[model samples]
Target: MSGHSRLVELVPLYALDALDPSEAASLESHLEDCEACRAELDVHRNVAAQLVPDEPPAIHVWDRIEAAISQGDEGEVIDFGAERARRRGNPFNWMLATAAVVALVFAGVLVGQRLAFDGLSTDEGVVAAAESAAEEPGALVGDFLVDDVAVARVVLSKDGLGYVIPTDALDTLDPSRTYQLWVLTPDEVAISAGVLGADPGPATFTWKGDIAGFALTREVAGGVVSSAGDVVSVILDT
Candidate 1:
């Protein structure tokens, strides 16, 4: 496999220390520059950490494992069909059972990570996420318009994580006021997505559920729970 693809596949195994030294080193090096892979690794690591139960298994669990090991030691013909049937019937194969559970948990975590924002706090990371979202199949892309003229652009992923990129069309506001982003729902309720600075640049925010559209309003500095200011720009879902 290619470098990135190989590294991504190794992430879950790496979290469990299943990779050899060389493989681990390569994955670590690749993670330094790849934010998305790093995020995936983080998710896998978190799931692995949570796998340890608060209470230890009963003595019967250990007895079952020992019995399975003893049965493996006998020098008998290794028949693949019989082994499969044995494993299916054997309740002592706790290791295989545990592995299956871990696999299911990791699958769920990967799906959730894809839908949930990775919490990219830096400007560069936010821009990268937005650009990545723009390339996604179901991403919503549009322009924020004022008086029929475009003032800003937005790229919202299907999961509702999005970024707003402002243009020179929006003049800088006074120190006492700031640009606030509102996520409008079908009910016309305006939810505050984020507060952009007086001179807006590229910024990220997350909104759940259905979004009817988006709007930028000039509000008091630090923003407000309810907007009581001028609407600067609007972008409706088309």
Candidate 2:
């Protein structure tokens, strides 16, 4: 892959702060002049922000951090003053510090597993499916609107794979509720696509046969076999 293509592939990892130092530096430099990549970065960042729980980090996470700090390697030596001054001088260092703290909190919950949103795993394969669908021929893209105002976008490919990317206009629900995606048939039969989390993020689903459009509903967490919630937004297969 070319430089831009390679950087584009790293966008997701960069969003997660999973990129190595050198790769991140290169991508950050490229992002300054690449509007497309910057927008992609924003989308990934938004999805990540929505995934973080609103509640404060668990107490045990803090305890673990304290324990680790107190039990530092037996012979390890560090210059705390220099490290503090360096961090103070570089804003980016502060951002990295925050990211590290957030990572620690998330580690307690995620434990190296892929995040499962609405029964659908947002794994690399699923992300690749969405990217592939976007590049495929005969792919349909449309907006899901509420009160005629667009709140989310949906993509449906010829091979029956679909992806949903929500906008900030969509409200985040409480722990008791979640957003659900449904595939609607021409006859108006609704098929469950997946249960999106309380704060809907990018999601991938699969469907076979013809679909009239797509709908999003706010349902109880864990979702329902049959939707008991009202449709919040929809995109017609026009």
Candidate 3:
């Protein structure tokens, strides 16, 4: 046989480390001259490595393997004539068995998909879904991040007066640069509330103008004559 075929034939012995030193040396030297032998040897070696399990499994995997060697994966092979006769006797039953397996697999896939789909809609997910829904206006999901980092989601209430709500629990509101709620669109500026600087957790407040007109802004402790800071948050239209 050619060197490549010889390598294939020798592969099981090489994998088992049963090759004699002289034979192994000859094979290694041959590998340098025969590229096909080297390639085939590498493939066989990789297959051997994969046969070793990564960990001690919980179940007895070797039980079936032992049985498989004595009897083939399907069953003990019958004489071809006998096998033909048996197949002829039960062709309809074989088709039914195959169909049942296919139906079971299809049901399992559908159940798995439904479970994944149901899992997507969580309590936390509901708020995002509500906001994204086509009919409803965008909403303010309150700040849950950054401890001691104060956030005020100033929402303009429907009745026109603005509510200055603290997104997080605030520290002592800055006495000097008071947090004043300002209603500002592209045009006019109006003070919703002069900075209380001490309102705890989601406080409601009064508006200087119609909430429908301008977006909201926070200014110094005492309300500002002009815009000082950015529009912290805006109630987006539904």
The lDDT for every candidate, in the order shown, is 0.63, 0.62, 0.39
Looking at candidate 2, the ten consecutive residues that score lowest on lDDT are 99-108
**Per-residue lDDT over 76-187 for candidate 3, one digit per residue giving the tens place of the 0 to 100 score:** 3212123333545432222222221110011222222211212122333432332232122331222211232324433333333333444433333322234544332222
- Measured with C-alpha atoms, the lDDT of residue 157 in candidate 1 is 78
Instruction: TM-score each candidate.
Output: 0.47, 0.45, 0.28
Judged by lDDT, which candidate is best?
1
Winner by TM-score between candidate 2 and candidate 1: 1
- What does candidate 3 score on TM? 0.28
Error of 3 at 163 (Å): 2.3
Clash pairs, model 3 backbone: 137-238, 177-221, 178-220, 178-221
> lDDT ranking from best to worst?
1, 2, 3
lDDT of 2: 0.62
The residue pairs that clash in candidate 2, if any, are: 118-195
Better of 2 and 3 by lDDT: 2
Tens digits of per-residue lDDT for model 1, 2-73: 889877998888878799978876876677678988788789879988998789778999996676556545
